[model samples]
Target: MPAFGLMPISYRAIGVAVLLAIVAGGAAALSWHIQDWRYGRQLADLAKTQAEALNQLTLAAANQQRAEQDKRLALEQRLQASDQTYSKALSDAQRDQGRLRDRLATADLRLSVLVDPSDADAGSGVSAASGAGGMVHGTVRARLEPAHAQRIIGITDAGDRGLIALQACQAYVRALAR
Candidate 1:
């Protein structure tokens, strides 16, 4: 009743199938390990490059900051020097002004005497012979030397600038009278 050319399953064929499956599993595992190693190397290279870039950036930033600090310091030094110069100039100007004021006062006193030599003697007639040219302490002379008289006359010509006011004149007159 069995059909010709029909065969039953063998244990040897099952063993060959199992062997093939094992070989395929080994190949797949090898491929996965290789891919993992390649990816790891790529990641390592990327990290190294990033680290280098960060270091460069940090160095550049430090340099920039130092340069800016130096500029600020230079500006501050210039400002300090300018302040010192300004202070010195102000002091010099003030000194010059004081000198000018003293000169003006002396000129005014000289003019006051010229405009009214009588005012110099006032009611007392003290013979303000505190004489004409410079100052004469004693003895009235019959006449003044031409040059001394000219010098006294010159004081009046400072033209209004050196002349004392009427009030100032009266004050001087009073002071003289005293």
Candidate 2:
């Protein structure tokens, strides 16, 4: 109510306001610090979870690639084995053909074919030529000359080789299908 009383009361009110303001500012700063710590923990947990998922994915991809590589290696081994077997067969055929040709050249063997009796050159299923010395059956046997026999053998050799090559190709296709 008096001017002197107002001065003392106003001083006391100003001191209390300053103390309250300090306390409020401290409380606000503490709340912000707590929130920052909690949010930081959540962010770290999310990052850890993502890293683990990525690691698992990488392992799975590596395993799949390894399995594919193993399968390819097995296929290559099988193909190589098949190729070797086919190669052996082809060589065996060639050796046999060579022996047969040698025998023909030495006259140890002769080539013959059945001839029709109605033909002027045919016999009664037999040929009494000096070089021909084999019994004939019901069909007239006609002996081919060395040159003609050699040509026939060559044709047969070509046919045999072609068949073997075809069989090799078929086997290769079957292996791939599996």
Candidate 3:
């Protein structure tokens, strides 16, 4: 055997060291690739979660809008029904007013025919009474008869009441139309 140094160097040992270094480098590279793949998976999971949350938010907004539309539609229907009811009531009131006017006109005509011509002309038109001895004579001077005066007052009162009632009815109808 040749003289060996304190630390002997051999070709087989050098080869073994080179092989170990190559294996260590390949393992390190594989570890780095695995870490990168794990990072990418985590990012994908985070994006999926955010997308799901956004979808939920969109769905909630759509539902709220639909509810609002339904409410508005229902309100419009109610308003339409109210308008129809008011229109019908107004029409009925108009018909009643027409009938009342016709009846009043007929009553007025009958009353006019029953009234004496002399009595009708006593106030403003030509009087038919003849003056005798400076005393103006008229158809008994309606004011002198107590019974006739009372009856006339009663009739006037009734007419005033009727007019008041008619005015009130008209006002009520106007209010309803509004």
Candidate 4:
């Protein structure tokens, strides 16, 4: 007897075993391919979402910048208008001040003539006649009566009140004459 306990191996069994191994490997490869495809799709979707978010953020930032610029421009325009108004006011004040100075000078001259008739320049055409005690223009009758002249002199003599008192005194004189 050759080998009583040993069983002989068959080629059919080996071929069947190899076929099963190939099928199992093919199944595993298909499963791995499907998993990779899903992972790639998920990554693409995440990228798309991130891109949309970035776009929205960019648009918001741009809008904010535009609003800031608009505000700055409006502020600048307001400042310019205020500056122009201030300049105009200053100009008007200066002009009024100049006119006031001129009036004050004329009033001072007239007052000087009235206070001292001897100091009156003949060419100035302002004179205080003897009995009138009031200023008389050359060849013209006295416009202020003696009482009005005295009252105006008293008002002016009281230490430098503003022009309002002088204006009031003149108005009073005019009303008395009327």
Candidate 5:
């Protein structure tokens, strides 16, 4: 070693050092870029998965709502049908009751005639009378105007009252049937 301004260095050693530095810097930059790209790709994949999951859940919710609406509509239709049936049944029952009332009224009119035909036909000249509670074995007495009886029957006949009495008996039986 002699006293010199600069230390003696070899050209090959300088070239090797320069080459090593360049290689090391390039490797470090490439590793950093690769890591950034990997992280960005991972974030993108995660966002895509979240969006797909959200879409599926929304579709499922819409399907459930549609099913519920269908069920509600079915229930409403059933209720309406039940109401119509009930109303018709009630109307039919009322009509039956009215028919029964009318039959009973007709029966009552016939019973009144059989019970006291004399009072019913008092203005018609023929007075057919009978006693109460003696309808089956009762006697009917017909008192007619002589002129009227002669005009209708050709004779003032009050003795042949058995036919009239048979009519009264038949009327009583008809009333009972009603």
Candidate 6:
């Protein structure tokens, strides 16, 4: 006699239940494996794309650096040429000034300035040779002292050098701008 009037369990039912469970587990495992393989392939492709982008960036940077270096070199060369040209001009001016000073020191050259008759003394400024309002009588021209003439030359020489230096600076700026 049964306690609750229930039917007895069978071996066949138990076997069928075990087989279904195994099939379900196998299907789930296969699905997980396929998903893992797809994810791995996607990751590999992403890494490749990143590597190619990095390579392109590196090449662009290198080319930009090279272009900048070349431009700097060209500017330096132009500046050097300008410097040489100004240097030569300054040297020539100095040489010519030296020759003129030598001539003045030797009495071969005389510096003179034009004078107005009204501004000059009538008796003293007019030489006895020919003072009747003539050029030879020192009415229109006055001879400068040697010391004063040398001082004037010195001043002019300094001015010339300053002008040359200013020109050189301007050329340097232009080269840099280019």
CA lDDT of each candidate?
0.60, 0.83, 0.62, 0.61, 0.60, 0.86
Q: Write the per-residue lDDT of candidate 4 for residues 1-178, one digit (tens) a residue.
A: 3398767768899899899999999999999999999999999999999999999999999999999998778666665665565556555555655554555545532322233444445454555455445535442333454445445654543423344345445544544454
Q: Could you tell me the lDDT of residue 163 within candidate 1?
A: 34
- Mark the regions of model 4 whose C-alpha exceeds 4 Å error after superposition: 1-13, 106-178
**Per-residue lDDT of candidate 5, residues 56-123 (tens digit):** 99999999999999877866666566556555555555565455445444553122223354554556
Expressed as tens digits, the lDDT of each residue in 76-109 for candidate 1 is 6665665565556555555654554555545532
What tens digits encode model 3's per-residue C-alpha lDDT throughout 32-87?
Answer: 99999999999999999999999999999999999999877866666566556655
Report the backbone clash tally of model 5. Answer: 0
> Number of the top candidate by lDDT?
6
**Total clashes, candidate 6?**
0
TM-score of each: 0.49, 0.75, 0.54, 0.51, 0.48, 0.72
Against the true structure, whose TM-score is highest?
2
Model 6 TM-score relative to the real fold: 0.72
Candidate 2 Cα outliers beyond 4 Å, as residue runs: 1-24, 117-137
Clashing residue pairs found in predicted model 4:
none
Off by over 4 Å in 5: 1-23, 102-178
lDDT of 2 by residue, 1-178 (tens): 5675654558778889998999899889899989999999999999999999999999999999999999888888988898898889889988888888888999999987866667625545454333344554445666889889888888888988899889889988988898
Model 5 residue pairs with clashes: none
Using TM-score as the measure, name the better of candidate 2 and candidate 4: 2
Better of 2 and 5 by TM-score: 2
lDDT of 5 at 101: 46
Instruction: Report the C-alpha displacement of residue 34, candidate 6, in angstroms.
Output: 3.5
Give me the overall lDDT of model 5.
0.60
- Candidate 1 wrong stretches, greater than 4 Å: 1-13, 106-178
